[model samples]
Target: MPFEVREFPEFSWSFSRHKTLLTCARKYGYEYYASHNGWLYEADETAKHAYRLKKLTNVPLAFGQIVHELAEKAVRLFLKHGYVMTEAELIEEGRSMLNRAYLDSRDRKQLWMQKPARYKMLYDMYYKGELNRLEAEDYRGRLHVVFANLLNSRSFQDITTRPLSMQFQQAEEFRFMTVDGVKIFVVMDLLYRDLDAGKWVIVDWKTGKEAENDRSQLALYAYYIMQKYKARVEEIEIRNEYVLSGVNRTYQLMEEDIGLMLEKMKQSIHIMLRYQLDMISNEPVEMDEFPRTEYRQRCETCNHKEICLAQ
Candidate 1:
């Protein structure tokens, strides 16, 4: 007798999910389908382990998350109170977050949800008495430098200077709608409506280098907003701010571009469906179904490399 495979749905498409599928289908299958069991502390041991592995984050991702969270909070505070932190204050806030998280993970080993990179910095700063240790974790203070760059960057400066009365928003704003049976979700880091220019600005902050995916993500945001607001593609402006490098790229969807991105979304949905059918209903999914990535270099940074074994 065999157990039943879970029924994979077509209606859930997130940028993160799309990214995984684009990166490596095998990894996508592992993350979304194989390792997607719900919390069942009383369930089988194997199930518990799978859930834990699904939730783990690596050092680089952890660092980015920290930066994003603190940045979001700091900006949220500023949007509400017109208060901005100085560089030294930002560094202190970052260190405090790192130190608290480090102590939490250190004391509770199994409950540790953070990566070792953060803990290493905190450990050196306190126990090892190394005052200059943030550099070691983020490599020459890259993390702090990037954070400062964001605080001082023109893009962010605009955010701070804007009056609280004008509608400035954060990622807590999201919209979901079904497009030909596929559910699409979009969240923006900051959204500001400029009545004077008659434009809707959708801003996304990036702590990493520019990539084609970044552009694709902006396209998706534009498409979704066009659908949600029934606004002209020309009225929607998408801004991608790479804070680390102080580079800002803005994109707007033309009428033709909207059609193209929608088609792209449909194509991605079908690709995911093709992989889903192979993985869920069948055992020993054919290698060709969720084909390993041709670019082996990407495997080095992938979290599911061990499971994928993609050369």
Candidate 2:
């Protein structure tokens, strides 16, 4: 058989992608366009470097990911085997995962450079060459708090104590829906049928403090849920489970809320399309067409700063 020729993935819209575009157009280009096919052995050095930088993670992001993973693990255990991981077990596993990442970034530079997709290269270590000991300890403490809060979270209790039959959708699953002919991606942390409330509950696990965009993000998820599940505004319940603080904030979304979210998405897509060379082909223009942000401070923490700043 002949070797298969690979093509770049089609462009797609997502909440995170929209945010990235807003944050820095150049970064958006590198992440979604320039890095395309960077995995190919014959790819350019610039594309390869950008792709490696794109995979860089920091302490906060890594912490949130680990917590989400553990949360998914807990849901799977209870759903599949009628078991929930103990708090001690959750903390132990979280710490171990974090430690491995830390060690990888600290000691496995050659390995990470060789296989950035498989190995973790933390942003802090990559740029600063070392992490502050005090900060590392603080994140470890935060990890413990997140797991403890997760166990005590209302969403977790509802998931574990409620009937397994009430579960409506899989946790942490990649799902998408189309609006105005544009594909929108959504990954619900936890979604279930609330028999008592006669509604579908969408839980978003938060490992860090709340941000202004949290409600809007959930609103977008609600839009997808409504479209895909044929759920009405009243039939859907939105929740932000801030595991770090053990706060479960529920938002009562109206049809108007989802409508606004759709409009925002449309506007965002329109802006992004301006930077593309061919909307049909999802092709991006020259690198210089996507300008870097005027704000210099943001670049300090940007993953693509190495290649970006070199310009």
Candidate 3:
């Protein structure tokens, strides 16, 4: 395969899209292709009803979003100004935010949350200190730890002092030109130049647990920068700060990795193009082509289980 690193491509390949396709083609079809039944006004009654549930998230996903927002705020403050919120402050604010989400979800739980109403119930139980013995103990216990881990990290400390020539902080999805005419979309949490190392650095703060797919995520960011920028960057260093464990995994990219990453992108892009075309033509993808997971246990926790009938 001829690897051509050029200017950024138009909006196309996103991490979520690829992940969805890999996880379940039917889910991907329901999401991206069908726009999660987003036609709304034009959508049939069934589609309109299904679209609402498509976006409903469970506790873990909601909790992760909350953490990401908090971390973004804390990190932005330290970067723009030399201020770090104390651990206590972080915990207090986290609890407060959790409370707010609970109230909001609870008020509207009838419309969205199912019987037992986990969304509203989660906050209600946590305040009552029930998670201490429940299966949710891990999330509650590690809740405030991410603040300390992120604030104390070497790179984070340096971010407070060392100014970069250029930086993109959790900016909107980056869209650019691709040689193959396959557009790519990715939201970079952070990308900046390191004057000392002369390497562009990308940081993606991960929560909860680390997954093997993280490696490719960082690699894709580097691939985007390399293709987008005209400057002759020696290398791009990517960092994954798994806040829950205070683990910082860094990867430096050279020609070897970039070449390999491009190959991977090619495969993903090809599938994406076909899937997109199928959707655009209003062609129904064969259900067997995107079968449910063999692991029935996974469906127990999947948000789409009800809609997909995975079991």
Candidate 4:
């Protein structure tokens, strides 16, 4: 296999930027530099909580990945067997696949995490001399077979046969090039294609429910696809599976919609960057505490609530 390396100058846009700017640009600016300056997560408890989640690549975000895997597998199985599965069956298979995948892929990603020593020490402790390299391979291969079997089961008909074909292609670091000379980094969830239409689409799988109007976060994905593939972004979908009624709703992307999002992201970067430059020129800066916001019903189950309430 061959891989190419590309570089985007020292800049990027993230969804957090869009939200932060919407809430408070001054806060965005101070936090951006404070974050990169290496003192933000350490001094601020909320920042620390956010940082930990972002760094969690193992089974942390596994639920959605597992769901997608099972759905896709079900589609394949349905294609082969001409059978459709209930949503409940698909969800159950998804959980099983997730556990298997976590155990199997743990070692492959062990080397790549920003923190390797953490897992390395854990692996060292768990390994037994009796099980050699061959045993490890057997363990991984068996799990892969199990996961594939679950994915190819019959219940995933709807998502599989749908006109939209999607795959998750992500890296801890994303290299982006823009007309403004902005190089961006992101952790992406899904990249989609309408094979029949030959158009590019981006989908982000959300475990929680979202409003139909809530699209600012996914707009960054549209921006990246437009720039990276040089193809007109036909649609941007945010699949929120964790809805109040447990239904998934998709929003279509219009040119104007993405344009506004980019404008906001750009403004956010500008605001944050300007403040960061000023702060660098100053003596020193301390990270701000996570500002308190109203706790919505949706936020009750959010992983960040503990830290939010603590603040």
Candidate 5:
């Protein structure tokens, strides 16, 4: 076969991407630009390093990811296999996953360093040399609360108990919709039609404390559902299921909210476009064009700190 060149990374927008750009321009460059083709053997060292660091996850994020995975698994099992995972089962499964990840991060340092994409690398382990024992146990202990809350959550109960035939979208499925010729990426935790209420519901499983931007993120998901599913704003209900805290907050989207979100997205895209040397190719300008954040605290926790601080 003839050699085929790799395609350049496509420019896309997501809530996380927008937040990253707002957080620090330099970190955004490392994540979206510098790490583009770092998997190739001939790639420069900086690109390779940035790519590896980008894959690093801390304790909180890893914990949240595990919860999300289990939540998806539970939903699929009930909907497809007619089996519901009990609280005990969920806790056991979560513990097993956590143990395996901890071992991978602790014992497989060499493998992770060589191919970070294929293995887990805890930020605490990489930078601090070890995870604090108390912190690890704390997360482990919270597994019970998390799983219990998940089982008792209003959304979870509603989803599993309702007819499996209800129109629903699976969790963790990467999906996108175009707005004004720009691709907007969205991944919903769960979405289903509430047959009783005659409403389409969008559920976001939150494993962390509620943040100010949580509603905005859900609004974006609501927009995706509205556009692709052709549901009206009046007929849709958005929910933030805070599993850790056992709180479920619901919001009704307005046409005006979506309008504002679109405007915000457009402005963010315009700002990002300014840094591109070639818009068609998504090629970024000089590294310096993306300035480092003045906040030292952000740098302290940044994934690209190794290379970013060096510069």
Candidate 6:
């Protein structure tokens, strides 16, 4: 007897278009789907610590809390002094915040490991240089535009707008399926309304040099959003903020482009279905000629990198 292959509808909705595709299709099949790669949310250790401490009986969130506090302070100081905050000052504030948290009687060494000095040093590097560099050079002149979308009172906004009100550390998960009946779950960094256009915008934040060939990810995401909500999607935006370099770039989705991508997604899914059918029928796998993908420095940080190897 054979087990049944799982399949589900693709009409689900989500702020995260990326996850929806991933959840719905085979990972390799959806490799070209819109991608959200970056360090803004992934780099901050403080938020990770803070989230962990939620059930730790007051063990205080570590790096992210301190970093946010320090960053808020740094932003304030930047506003007042009209100068860049030095790396050392940010580190000092972060250290002080960490110390205050660690020394709290309720937080001492009970549920958490003492943060290593190296971690603090790494975070300082991320803040003082990496994040700053990207923001200054690549992402210059878009702060207000980005902030407006992030700070909206609405539940969903684009990455550019939402980061202003909430730190990149926060994310929302959305689930939907493709037309071919595959369930997907995307943990979106941000979603927003394009007020001027009266349309919903979906976003994914990126941290490095934007990939010219990665529009597929965005396109698939946009198609899913349109399919799920039955709303006119004005645009799909991807905010690539180079945390290490501090550079930012925004990509907007066009109508024709999305249409082409939707077609591509359907083709890919059918190809994947064939692969699944072949596996079930005990057919020999016709592997790709050059099977191995080159390693990317970013791969070290990818959640799916380990699984990629097995594939």
Give the TM-score of each candidate.
Answer: 0.78, 0.95, 0.78, 0.48, 0.94, 0.39
Predicted structure with the largest lDDT when compared to the true one: 5
Q: Candidate 1 — which residues are off by over 4 angstroms?
A: 1-11, 99-107, 113-136, 170-174, 277-289, 294-301, 305-311
Please give the ranking of all candidate structures by TM-score, highest first, separated by commas: 2, 5, 3, 1, 4, 6
Deviation from native of the Cα of residue 48 in model 5, angstroms = 1.6
Model 4: residues with Cα > 4 Å off, grouped in runs: 1-11, 20-159, 162-179, 233-246, 278-311
Error of 5 at 169 (Å): 2.8
Tens-place lDDT digits, model 1, residues 137-182: 6632666787778887655777776654355644555577788866
- The TM-score of candidate 4 is 0.48
Residue runs of model 2 more than 4 Å from their true location after superposition: 1-7, 171-173
User: Over 4 Å off in model 3, which ranges?
Assistant: 1-11, 35-42, 110-133, 164-170, 173-179, 231-233, 273-289
- Candidate 2, 139-201: lDDT as tens digits: 898876888889889888887777643755755455888777888899788888887888888
The segments of candidate 6 whose C-alpha lies over 4 angstroms from its true place after superposition are 1-174, 184-187, 194-197, 235-238, 277-311
Residue 103 lDDT in candidate 1: 55
Write down the lDDT of every candidate, Cα atoms only: 0.65, 0.86, 0.63, 0.45, 0.87, 0.40
Give per-residue lDDT, candidate 5, residue 158: 90
Clash pairs, candidate 5, are none
Give one digit per residue, the lDDT tens place, for model 3 in 110-157: 544332223443433333423333534555566778778877765676
Model 1 residue 37 CA deviation (Å) reads 2.6
Answer with 2 or 4, whichever has the higher TM-score.
Answer: 2
Write model 5 residue lDDT over 44-102, tens digit each, in one string.
78778889999999878889999999999998888888798999999999999888778
lDDT rank order? 5, 2, 1, 3, 4, 6
Q: Higher lDDT: candidate 2 or 6?
A: 2
lDDT at position 110, candidate 3 = 52
